[model samples]
Target: MPNTDREVHLRKAVLWLQKKDPTTKKIIQTIGPCTHKMIGNPYYVLIRSVISQQLSVQAARTMENRVKEYYGNGKQFPKPDVLVKLTKPQMRKAGLSFAKIEAVKLISKAYLDGSISDRKLSKLNDQEVLDLLCSIKGVGPWTAEMVLMFSLDRWDHFSYNDLILRKSIENNYGIPMNSKKEILEFTSGYSPYRTIFSWYLWRASVGIENL
Candidate 1:
């Protein structure tokens, strides 16, 4: 429901996935419809993803909010120009590690310099987008993958870097994460809709009904 514009498209993807893989179908039936939240601002998405690295959900939210409070207006995420001005101490006060602080700065700089503009990225293919984002020193494959799913809404992405997705695939289908070839081969069936498949996998991992 998060992406109203893509509801019909997602429904089609869901049906395709249900037919393509039984494990994914089961996850969809259990978790309900795909509810991938799409954000228009790629810069905001990338920065938040950086902040969330290696942290619990609650802890990451707290830190992200504190950073927003310091550099942003109210609860709104700060713009690249605003966030570019953030000092190391300010980032530290918000619980960002030294590496994370550097990552944040690099992301903000990428936006400001037009190395990764939203408009420009929107025009590129998924691989191109990934390459452009990964060119930044702090942005990794995982962060770039997050942008593809949450920001650009690319449909075919499945991140091997996402531990939750890897675990869910292994738990549900007995596909070991270490077997990159097997994982890619298995997930290839959901091509052009793997993003939806991945969304269901994430929901299955957390037991959405219990929540």
Candidate 2:
């Protein structure tokens, strides 16, 4: 129940994962133990996902800082109600597209109104969480998958639609770009460790120091 205990428990999941897949074992031995912890609110994670859509990492962070500064007085991300109050034009001023502004509004309203509570969402499995989040306006499968892995700490998720993940697989495994079935089958061996594999693949895509 304590935060430290929870942190330990989550890291233990990574150890279990390392044992489950050899590729993961090799990756982690080089990268060191995965230290990712589930922190922050789900609503904020989803909002960031929406804002970062189709943008480079540098550009996305710039836009994200603008939104945070404008709504949160340069202190933190805006609270849900405050985020909802920011009108479309105001959001656009912060670099959000019209569609993304609407998405943020919908997600903020859901957060404010308790439709997307952390407690409720935390209880759902990855697939259920994916389905619920994807029901929102700007949340595609990739966005929902990101939320599941990074926000909720669901370790089994692998985004079939994530281009970076696909590229990583193709380059590392020599799987063809179009071979979705082969990719899925290969990754399935990772089982509960797929997200851990995904984290490594993401690292590999960016040129990990080891390889």
Candidate 3:
């Protein structure tokens, strides 16, 4: 459950979205107010996003659990120092691919070197945060966007790099999102509240076939 503050914010965001886009309004009416919680630590969420790339949800969860179990008794996420020490063989044992292991290492290194500072990130705007995260070797715009939306709980974030979102917009809005410009133009109406829009779209995508 969202806290009192988040609940109020969700209400406002939903109302704003309902007025901005008819399709998303229908989704909000069907799903009710957004109840999604942002619970993960910033670095942990980034690492999990890396693990999740190109994998099914179940597979990603399995791999993430394996890493946790190997390093932190399956419950706690490893600290940056511990995670940065992961060897190729150890990561392989935890079901991480070579590329993902590198990404994880680079993310861990950023944390250890103070390149990724939680306090500093908390002060940044959405674009600033994206710029900082995307500066790392393995972090892309998509990963940075996840950090903004999932970890920082930035309500305005909309990632053109997220295929699921593009498809959801296409299916729900009946608009072709073949290009970034089209997606941006369509989503621009929900600015400063696209996170709410995204949460509802994720819900709508669950049972929608052909997505």
Candidate 4:
């Protein structure tokens, strides 16, 4: 959540979106209010997002838990040193694919070399953060965008290429097969709260809580 005045603006954002797009309005009505609790620690957020790629929610959580249990003493995720020390076979034993293991190792190497630090990363703007993180071999725009919203608590960033987000938009608004440029322009009015819009679309994607 934002500060008091920001909350006021967010409520107003809700109303403005309701008036601008019917699909958004219906979703706002049913979903009621944003309950997004920000996750912590940039490093952990990146690791978890990588682990979650192409997996169901439950399966992802299970794999994440396994990682935490083995390397993190069953309390929290391991630190960068622990991640760097774990061999590929050990990471695979934790249920990560070979590719994801490599990804995690690259991330750990970046951390150790001071290429990306929580302190340094926290100060960078969204675009800079995206570029720097994507410089790593395995990280990409989607993962960087997830870090922006989940870890850094940036409100405006959105992942245009996420399949589920695209599917949700199509299902709710009947706007599939549009180019990324058009989709982004269509969402421009959402502005700083695009992440909130994404949360609603994610809910809609599952068909369980959708209107």
Candidate 5:
């Protein structure tokens, strides 16, 4: 289970990051809100992560809509039982790649078999969650990191493997970042709120928007 006062931890993390490094201060200043819409449900989080993989926001949104339409009402996310029953052709018709369809099936199977559940996941640590998530086909470290940040609300995740983040870090630090390990090391100073730092990096990589 998460610490009782997760928000307190988040606030502490933000303060710690601001004090630890000047670059992080700039990042926080640039990206006004680190906390956005929370993905509280595991099923929705998994679905959104899958839909967004390797796709632009517009494309992902389109695909997500199509999937939701097929599932009906679009309010309730498709359950694992319903998703597992979807044939690859049907999923492909909904704009998902065959690989993604297969991956979704694997995840659904895991869920139905009691290997992955909401309560079970909440009991695991961050690393444990990552490990369990990666056991599913087509789910990688980056995807697992997304689940941790958006779904589980883990405050400290930094996806150094993200290209936009790498670019932002390089620009901020005035140093070329060619290795994920190096990026991880550089982000260590922003402990407990590395995800917030990462959100800032992503925003900075794009453009500043009105808060």
Candidate 6:
């Protein structure tokens, strides 16, 4: 089910961003609304983000579809036992890289072993979630951030590690690209609404004027 209550949190963040700076306001005005919230399950979020890493959108989608097909339309994202049932060659036929196959299996193992669960994850704070997620193989800060923002509906998140976001920041601020720390420092003013700003930045990076 959708977390309707999180919408209030996001709305509050939008208000905060409007008050923080004129640039944010301009970006908000340009970008009507953020519509990036498509993920439902944290497991699916992890899987999709992992698949998307360093790959083009079309490639990622193609692979994702293949995996979904392999799992009968991904009714439950394939449990650990289900995943383990498949051979490495079968996973490769589903378009997963050898490394990704291992990574997904590891995540499935974590899930089945009761190391991570939706209920447990719901009780943890953002940093704790990040720490826990990064402990798994093939999952990094960027993928964790996606889960936080899209799946968990966190209002405050901005990935300085995202190159497109960095490019957009440079373009919007008319400044040279700098370190992640510097970018984070510069974006501090838009706290709580950094995710919204990130949406705009990503849009701008893609030459989308409407944002």
TM-score (C-alpha) between model 6 and the true structure: 0.86
Taken over the whole model, the C-alpha lDDT of each candidate is 0.82, 0.79, 0.81, 0.82, 0.77, 0.77
TM-score per model over all chains = 0.91, 0.85, 0.92, 0.90, 0.88, 0.86
Q: What lDDT is reached at residue 180 by model 3?
A: 80
Q: Write the per-residue lDDT of candidate 5 for residues 27-129, one digit (tens) a residue.
A: 7776654553355577678877877788866787788888888864685558889999988888889889988888888988999999999788877999999
Candidate 4 lDDT over residue span 1-211, tens digit each: 4477667776776776678667788888988876654677889889988998888778988999999998898968899998999988889988999889999999999999999998888899999999999998778898888888888878786678678888777778777635677677766767877887887778766742421
Candidate 3 clashes: the total is 0
lDDT of 3: 0.81
Which digits, one per residue and each the tens of the lDDT, describe model 3 over residues 28-146? 89877677677587887888888888776678779889889998768877988998887899889998888888988888888888888777787899889988988887789888888
Q: Would you list the clashing residue pairs of candidate 1?
A: none
The TM-score, computed over Cα atoms with residue i paired to residue i, of candidate 1 is 0.91
Ranking by lDDT: 1, 4, 3, 2, 5, 6
Q: Candidate 1, which segments miss by more than 4 Å at Cα?
A: 1-5, 207-211
Minimal lDDT window, size 10, model 4: 202-211
Off by over 4 Å in 3: 207-211
Query: Which residue segments of model 4 deviate by more than 4 Å?
Result: 1-6, 207-211
Clashing pairs in 2: none
Deviation of model 2 at 19, angstroms: 6.0
lDDT of 6: 0.77
Stronger candidate by TM-score (3 vs 4): 3
lDDT of 5 at 190: 70
RMSD values for the candidates in order, in angstroms, are: 2.5, 3.1, 2.9, 2.5, 2.8, 2.8
